[model samples]
Target: MFSRAVRPAVRAGSLAVSRTAPSNAANFATLREIEGRLKSIKNIEKITNTMKVIASTRLTRAQKAMEDSRSYGQTSNTVFENAETKAPEDKKTLLVVASSDKGLCGGIHSGLSKATRRILQEHPEADIVVLGEKAKAQLSRTHPNAIVLSFANVCKDIPNFNDAQAIADQIALLPNEYGSIKIIYNKFLNAQSYEAGTVEAYSEEAITQSPNLSAFETDEETLANLREYALANNLYWALAEGHACEISARRNAMEASITWGFGPEPD
Candidate 1:
């Protein structure tokens, strides 16, 4: 219906558009892929930001509680430290390890595991009550027989008096009747620095038998109550502090993981 000259021009224009269509579709596909990845990165950024906020809030509250607990624990145990309470000879020992049940933090759980192994090497006969599954798994591999009790679903939040009390009650029910209880936890030195530490919760007998016990005021029935209370108090402090360490370590590790979103590492 048109002249030959115009027909040739129209056909050439149609061929050019046909040749470019695939490239346009390919470009759109590449753009969509890039967009999907960008969205993923953005989502991760949001998650990272949210976690940072949560960690900061938790860290603040944990620090406040830890300060109060630390003061209380120090004050409560000052007497025992002053008296130099020593466990009796040849009695069973209970190691109450304070660690979290989860992962994602750098060396936080492993540090406690290594420390626990070292302690086991030193006191091969001592029994242990692991507070978290992370430590339980590590210790179970080599020292399964030594693990008497293990509690999970711990360290998801800041520890309170009730948590400590419950753990202590279970420990008290154990038939071993340990001469002394030692709590090993990761001590939060700073945001980036942590190390394993131990706090002793002496038995009622040790408390009464302390060399300088007579120096304190007279109390017949209060010694048992004090022993129980101090055990809970120490556990509360250790759990709270160790929880803070985990949160701090997780926040730091998460922050570092952001770089991985860029791409694969260079060879």
Candidate 2:
């Protein structure tokens, strides 16, 4: 009888152990699911690494071009500064805004567009010239009354002096037709950061009032020559910066795509 009672107690303990076994099995299953996700993320990281390398190579070339053009840009600005001193009193302000044609660079295009919008709000009557499709699309919605000169697909391909001249011609002629000119573009500071620089054409009154007239010692003929040079240089700077921005954006997009398993192959 005592042996029979002991057997019943043993059976009760066995039932309790069996009940807890399923919980341990469930925990193991959860761990396996987590491990699978981690493995997927690792694969994605490898692809992103490859893309980053490619982008970095392109960025170096773009940086060299930007650096090489600095002196010319400074000289051109000096000429414009001098011309502003003698420019006529009545002139409309023209705003030229540059942005990338495509998206996915993590706030670059949007930030540039936002900066442009702020400038437009500040100068309500300014004529607008857009260098990229993205800027044109975004600005057109808000500034319906602002005149937009659209340049499509200029950001992706190699930008040359002719491209710069075309844009500069449009900008330089604005003073005769409108009054003054301004250029808004992203100055590439680093791979991750850019400064929104606004280059404005100074009015005659503003130029006369300013004390910094000593830098420009050129006559009318030289001043005209410098103006052309400066416009071209400015356009070149904008293009170089745009190229850097494109690479940065593509790198960022590739990273995101890798993380999500949506981008092209890493090569």
Candidate 3:
């Protein structure tokens, strides 16, 4: 009787141990999965923080450049503004889209795209010259055939006169004799704001036909050089301001990310 009773107790204990073993193993596996998720979150936080720092570092330089370029661009447009040059509605138009290849900058590119679409609604015959892949992709969705030229690998850094000159040279080479050239870009309003803006480059005929052209004494050759120079200058200004806007937008996005706990808690 004692042996039988002892054998039953042993079996019961063995069964309990087997059941508890699985429970322990399951708990360990759950803990491992939790640890892995925490690790991934930490890694994401690190990357976000790094990008935030970089954006902050770039913001100052970009703003300063934006200001200087604004002055330069305004001065370049003085002649046209003074002359009251108007684009001829009868001729075809060219739109130069100033956007970049990189994306984490919120709606900077999309805003420009929307503005372009709105302008196209007004001038459906306008041909597109996209400066960045981001804008190209966005415009291609609705206006694929309108894209006359799409450039890549631009505005990755602060824009310079040389970049603008190269782009203007390419535009000048296009087969169409565009009546007007308009550059669409993001205008930086403040640290947390930006909007779509346009900078116009008048054609030689438009400049010559301006109602007030008689106020400035110049020849055809000089007018041609001025047109090229002004186009490049305006392009440089637009690109610089757009770059600043993008940096600011990126910084704001990072700030929002951190606020939403995508990064480490603020100190």
Candidate 4:
């Protein structure tokens, strides 16, 4: 019943419809892929949420410790400032750098390492004292000849004053050949940022140059005792700061791992 012209028109219509079908199918496939990715992200959000909660809980204790030590550390430094005016002078410098033994804490290790490297580059002749295995390992590679002392496996649980004492003793006895001591560690500003600061141990020159010592009333014996106390307190503060940084780093790393579809579940 159909004419020959109608037959050719029907064939052309069928060909056009076939050409459009693949494109629509491809679009649908792409949509499905995107949906899968979104679901994965949601799963990650849940894990990160849990981790954030846990980190927040631990952060309270760490923050309290940090706050309590700040005053003690400052007072100790003031005492050192008073006594350093009489200490003997030398020419060599010793640098004490602290870091965490573990990784996966967002760039905590790398950041500390980078900062330490910059310090080393600035003072190429200084001797290095590294705390934590990670620091020892990294500095070993980047500065093979600089490291004079290293302490590893120091963070088992809560870092203690005893650990600080041990570290302080080592630093205090740096052959008495070194002119000055510099302690470098991450200063925790907040959850998201840290500053690497190098604090020089109070020295005779520092005391003479300081303009704020007139307020203190102390004699030589008391001044010497204060200097020793200040050194220990500084070491304690460094340990506490390092511990806080480790927690922050671990939390950040765990969250990142969750985001990247790692860990227990994958959506």
Tell me the spans in candidate 4 whose CA falls farther than 4 Å from its real position.
1-54, 78-90, 203-215, 260-267
**Candidate 1: where are CA atoms >4 Å away?**
1-35, 259-267
Estimated TM-score for each candidate: 0.82, 0.68, 0.87, 0.69
Quantify all predictions' global Cα lDDT against the true fold. 0.83, 0.69, 0.89, 0.70
Clashes of each: 0, 3, 0, 1
Superposed model 3: Cα runs more than 4 Å off? 1-29, 262-267
Per-residue CA lDDT of model 2 for 176-243, tens digit only, reads 46445677877777776677777655444444444555565645565556556666787777777767
Candidate 2 ranges with C-alpha deviation above 4 Å: 1-51, 79-90, 172-176, 201-219, 256-267
Candidate 2: residue pairs that collide: 91-179, 92-178, 92-179
| Candidates 2 and 4 compared by TM-score, better number | 4
- Among all windows of 10 consecutive residues in model 1, the one with the lowest summed lDDT is 258-267
| Global CA lDDT computed for model 4 | 0.70
For candidate 3, write residues 45-126 as lDDT tens digits: 7788788899999999999988988888899799899999999888899999999898887888989999999999999999
Give per-residue CA lDDT, model 1, range 74-170, as digits (tens).
8777989888899887787889889877686778887888888888787888999999988888888888999999999997778888999999999
